[model samples]
Target: MVSIVQTGVANRASVIAAFERCGVEATRAATAGDIEAAPFLVLPGVGSFGAGMEALRAAGLVDALRVRIEAGGPTLAICLGMQLLCASSEESPGVEGLGVIDAMVEALSQPARPRFGWNRVVPEFGCEVITEGFAYYANSFGVCERPAGWACAMSALEAPFVGAMRRGAVVACQFHPELSGPWGLKLLQRWMAMGVAAC
Candidate 1:
């Protein structure tokens, strides 16, 4: 079963449906135990950074997630979930993130409006799952620089930003693969296959 962290700020239905389309069983993680013990895990979100962090903390999942990700458990973090993996986000000043990745989330510089639509993701050399493809995006903030020790993919609204970052069994995407059509489904399949191979 693929366990999805219930952050309360996520588009949970769509994410679960996406996994179902991949022929996988997806369920909400009810406790930290559910998170740590999930065979495959997904952290998905669709709201402000502070609210996401707040919900995680309120649910007592902050430490569980840290431990799980630190142990290199297979995890897929999407959209706001990706930003939550970083140290902080400009969208919610003074709110601490999971700090899994050494980076900060910043607002898109050029397009004042939230980047909402399909954008092509250009994967860096050595990216295992992500390829050059159009992925759906619906965010106002993202990581600008590639964090050290991560294989990153870039997408541009006007200036380039980190579209995805992968290290070990953890893959974080600024774009929502669940909403990206065929390319997204293929990406999900590839990621799931990678996790299964690791096991």
Candidate 2:
């Protein structure tokens, strides 16, 4: 089973559906306790940084997530969820992030804004969870600097950005693997298999 954090600003239905397609049972984590006890958790977001943080705070999940990630919990954070792992985002000045990663989310240098559709992700090192493939992305802001101690993958809108980063059992993706078609489904399957093996 996969417990998905209910941030209220996430693409919940699609995420759940994706997990279902993977033949994994996916449920919403309605409380912090649910998050704490989940074997495999997913933090997905599709909105502004401040709004996502506000929803997680309102749901009383901020501290729970911090503890989970700090302890190297099996987690997959996507898009805005990936940004929330940082210390802060330029998208929301004065708003603090989860601080799991010592980096900041910044606006993309490209003028096109929200670089939508598919882009290729090239892993910087040998990564078990990330591979070189075209993944779907829909964001205007991204982390430009790769955090130390994490395996990173890169993608470019105009300039390069951290497309995915993995450390221990936690994997964060700036692109939507769930929406990336067959390549993405395979990624999700691999992630789920890894979680099962960890158990």
Each candidate's root-mean-square deviation in Å?
1.2, 1.3
Residues 78-100 of candidate 2: C-alpha lDDT, one tens digit per residue: 99999999999989999999999
- Per-candidate TM vs. native? 0.96, 0.96
What is the alpha-carbon lDDT of model 1 when measured against the actual structure?
Answer: 0.90
Model 1 clashes, total count = 0
Candidate 1 structure quality by residue, lDDT tens digits, 62-161: 9999999888889999999999999998898999999989999998964434778999899987675898999999998999999988899998877889
Off by over 4 Å in 1: 110-112
Number of the top candidate by lDDT? 1
Q: Which ten residues in a row have the lowest lDDT in candidate 1?
A: 107-116
